[model samples]
Target: MHSLNRLARIAAVLYLLIAVIGPFSIIYVPSTLVVAGDAAATTSNLAASTGLFQAGLVGYLIIFLAEIVLTVILFDLFKAVDHTLSMTAMAARLAMTIIHGLNLLSLFVVSLLASGAAYLSVFDPAQLDALVLLLFNAHDLGYTIGIVFLSLHVMVLGYLVYQSGFLPQVLGILLVLAGLGYVIDSAGLLFFDSYLTTPFYVAIPIAIAEVAFPLWLLIKGVKEEALPKAAPQPA
Candidate 1:
């Protein structure tokens, strides 16, 4: 059981890393590559640019798959905590997990559409219009839903971390910030069109903290000496 618990924790960490870092890095790299290239490039150069874009799309799909695995393993770890939280808190966490899983499926569909469009672009640009429309609309909607649920999930996670004593309060604070950043970014994209890009920067730190803190918790477990004991009160 101890080993199983440790494995679950490790899986959760890997999932978080792949899901957050993989997609972000992939997108940034290809975009940078394209921007740094010559403006007046040949068909081959364009093809290379497209190839970079395709790589990012593939990376997004990989991240989605990792997210699914991470969420499942985290759920298992939550069950292993051996601590009882409020019913509302438990429900919130479960809801967040379910919503995240749904978001992953939505992302997977978007990636498939993107991949199809990329392949079709090699033949004719006109062929990709419908796929592009479908992919963008789905992505926008998915982002909106994901941000809302993720915000709630992070808040719940903060509370859980506070109660667990196994995880640090600072980590919980970071989760809260990350959740708020998502909400702000999603809203900005939907409504403002132009706003501070701070959320994007905020996300990098949040992602790093998320992977680090959870892995630490899983490996070290709670500080046995620091854990508070449950007290019996009036019924």
Candidate 2:
């Protein structure tokens, strides 16, 4: 039981690390460097901030590696509740992580295009700029697809948490809502041309649920009394 609680805390720490590290690549770098509908300008920005762009790539890699470890820890923590469901959740999260890691290749292509290398000399500056923008858009689409898988993971993990008895039920409910929000937003991004133009309140549940869950894990760990007892060994 004590070991389980300790594992929960370790998971919490890793979750917190991901939360802190993710936004630098996902939010900060893009907003800092990408210009909407201006391919030349965006490429110029990338060239000017090569160090920052590289840092963003490193940040993404760190998050990807962390997610791999986190997936295993979570599966262990929840497997006693329902082994199959825990495995399902772990699988979904792993799928999302793989998608994200592969998606970085697009960004790497963008970086190479921005490098002004001799090998790229065949392409005109205008062509290179357009290619950079296209790769960036492709990366965005891939990220949305990854989010769909993450939604599945969150929803399944939420169900496990609700059934486990060792964790707070409210967190489980919030996670389900958050997962639903992710699904809705991902659908919008994939299907609707005007999705980004419209105002959306889906972020509220996502923010609250993600933030609260990790904080709870860090502070409360798990309820000792509610943990499942190990089966007795043969005498």
Candidate 3:
């Protein structure tokens, strides 16, 4: 059980790193460079930017693998602890695992589609136009589905955290906030485009909390004393 917990913690860390750092490095850094007027002076600079995208793709794949491992470890963790909180937590984690898996798979497909569109664009502009439209529709659908699942998953996690004495209340609060962000973003994309601005910022801190709390719980085994127990029946 202890070993499983350790593995869970390790997997969480890896997932978090790949999810957060990879995307930030790949997208944020180069874009910042361009915006700051620090971009390279030649066409090569634009071409080189694709390297960051490739790196991010690699990182995303690694995150996908880590998520799968984390799911298994969480299942083991669920079996190790016998308590109401643990059971609820297990359900929440399982739900999130399934949703996240689907999201990752969708992301993989979207990435491939986008890459294909970009490659085809070089040879035929008309083909690129059709591909772009198809990609856009696919992306919108994928985003909608992913956000819906993720919002539910985050809410479940928040509920589990609130019930589990082993987990910090602040983490639960953050999870709730994150879930709210997803909800808002989804609605915004469906209705108004301006609503998305705040979610990006909200997501950053929430991601940190997600990684920190899970890692803490997995490493320390819920502090034993903090574990919840069944209440005594009236006699």
Top candidate, metric TM-score: 2
Per-residue lDDT of model 1, residues 1-235, tens digit only: 4344465467656655675666563346334433222322222233445665556556666665665555455544444343333333345544544554565464345345445554555645433434444443454455466556656656566665656565677777777776677677767766785653546576775676666666665676555445444433224
- Which is the better candidate, 1 or 3, if ranked by TM-score? 3
Model 1, poorest ten-residue lDDT window? Answer: 35-44
lDDT of each: 0.54, 0.90, 0.54
**87 in model 3: Cα distance from truth in Å?**
8.2
lDDT of 3 by residue, 1-235 (tens): 2554465467566656666764564356334323222222222333446565456556645655665566555444433333444445445545544554554554354345445555554546444334434443454455465566567656656765666666667777877777777777777777785654545676676676666666666566454455444444234
| Clash total of candidate 3 | 0
Candidate 3 wrong stretches, greater than 4 Å: 3-8, 25-50, 75-123, 133-137, 199-208, 211-221, 228-235
Candidate 2 residue spans exceeding 4 A from truth: 197-200, 229-235
Ranking by TM-score: 2, 3, 1
Best by lDDT: 2
Per-candidate count of clashing residue pairs (backbone under 3 Å):
0, 0, 0
